[model samples]
Target: MNEIIRLEHVSMAFRMDLNRTTSLKEWMVTLLKGQHRHKDFFALNDVSFSVQRGDVVGLIGHNGSGKSTVLKIISGIYKPTQGKVTVDGHIAPMLELGSGFDYELSGDKNIFLNGAILGFNEKFLQEKHDEIVAFSELDDFINMPLKTYSSGMLMRLAFSIATIIEPEILIVDEILSVGDAHFQKKSRERMRQLMEGGTTVLFVSHDITEIRKMCSSVLWLDHGKIQMYGDAVAVCDAYQAAMI
Candidate 1:
């Protein structure tokens, strides 16, 4: 398989203020006194990886190990503080629940809005609207504002929108189980179909069993660094053992 995604010596750093200031005046006073301090927190440190086309790669890590950071960089949501990221295909990223949604707008409107952000034209979204709603089983709530919906409702809408386009690459970040058990099964089957149809997928999940089952390869991250990267079964087995 040809390479579809690659990250070279990638590092993402954020400036964190050391001092907490409650008000603008206090912040200004600290700055004027030269007492303000900031530290660079590296969410990803010199990480390198390459994914081939049609690969289902699972990212496993602790809560703050930069798994989400890696996905964001690959999805173009975040730019690395250092190094280069290359993606060769159109990406459908379900990085976060309701990420591209307008909460105040009805779910109906969000369908078009989010679809456009994913590079679909209004006409295309219009054509797929019914199918998306049908699959989500959100027909009753489709005309209601998103802010009123529960988390499961949001997940259903987001998953429907992200998968309807059949993108060349799909990026999922710990969202597969957000829905109800029935929907979870449906989503997993959908994911399997996508993988079988040769969609390159990069996903972050803490569920090692799911990772081993769905992934052809696994990338284990720890403390913002790669701990292991190899065959799914080998890396997952090592990661599980390390967790114990």
Candidate 2:
């Protein structure tokens, strides 16, 4: 199998300001007084993993266990404080709903803009424009300003544009929860199609059922560490046992 992503001892840390100090002056004052005002929060702790092309992997964790952090790092939105991350293919990350969209622009305009942000050039987007619109089912409102769109409409547009053009690696964080059930089903079908066509998928979700349905492998995280990494059903069953 072709390796699509590799991470070696990846770690991320954030500095938390306990005293609400947002300015350099305040930070310096606290620092000069022989006091540390910021505490280190390790979102990911020496995590290492590898994914191959055509693999559908699920990430499961409790709140604040660094599931989202790993996705962000893999998507190139965040850099790890330690270790190396290597991505060998084009990546499309749906980490946040409408994250790359311009709310002030028309939905039609934002589609092209967001597509470009996802690494698609104008020619690629042009070829898939009609399909994207049809998949979103937002033909009537496509020309309207995106700020006027309902949350569901926004999510549908974002999801459609993100998934319509297949990327070699796709990272999805729980953003699919925004759309209605019908749209969610459609999106899942699209994802399955992508998987069938050899796209690697990294899915992070709180819903075990969804993960079990979509992933062949699962990584269970707890307290910013890996609790288990193995077959989807086996890891999921262990997670359920631990929770119970």
Candidate 3:
């Protein structure tokens, strides 16, 4: 397998204000006095990893462990504060459902809109329109405005469009159970199909069982640092033991 994703000492940091000034006047006063309390918080601390083409890798960590930060950096939603990151394939990120959508627009229009945003041409979207709708099971609500739909409905449409492209690299962030139990099963089946067809996948999930079952390898993170990286069972076993 060829290397498709790599990170060299990649680190992401954010400047967080230590003082919470309620008024603009107070904030300006602190700024002028050079007393604006701020500190750099490292979300990813000199992290490094590589993933091969056609590999399914799972990222596991506790809340606020920077798992989402890593995904955002890999998705180009964020630039690492330090170190180099490289990706050799096109990425479809499902980090935020309906993130590319226009709420005022009808679902049908958003389909074309989101598909275009994902880099698909009009002709291709037209060809796959029916299939996407069928998979989402949103035939009745396809004409309604997105603002009128429920969160689960929006996620269904987003997942349908994103996976329909069969992207070279798919980034999923805890969206396996996007809808009801029925749709959750369907989504998992679809994800399995994508993996079987050799789409490189990097996903973050809290469910260790799902990670061990779906991922060939696991990247365990703790406090923005790598805890383990190896075979699914091995890494997960280590992480689970540590948690206990």
**Any runs in candidate 2 off by more than 4 Å, and if so which?**
none
lDDT of each residue in 41-126, candidate 2, tens digit only: 99989998888788899999899998888889988889999989999988887887578888889989998999988888999899
Q: Write the per-residue lDDT of candidate 1 for residues 44-117, one digit (tens) a residue.
A: 99999999999999999899999989999998989999999999999988877567899999999999998888
Clash-forming residue pairs, model 1: none
Per-residue lDDT tens digits of candidate 3, residues 1-244? 6999999999999988888788999999999999999899999999999999999999998999999999999989899999999999999888877788999999999999999988889999999999999999998899999999999999999999999978889998988878999999999899999998889999999999989999999999999999899899999999999989
Greater lDDT among 1 and 3 belongs to 3
How many collisions per candidate? 0, 0, 0
Q: Where does candidate 3 have its weakest 10-residue lDDT segment?
A: 91-100
Whole-model lDDT values for every prediction: 0.90, 0.88, 0.93
TM-score of every candidate? 0.91, 0.93, 0.94
Q: Superposing every Cα of model 1 onto the true structure, what RMSD results?
A: 2.0
When superposed on Cα atoms, how far off is each prediction in RMSD? 2.0, 1.6, 1.8
Candidate 3 segments exceeding 4 Å error:
20-28
Candidate 2 has its poorest 10 consecutive residues by lDDT at: 170-179
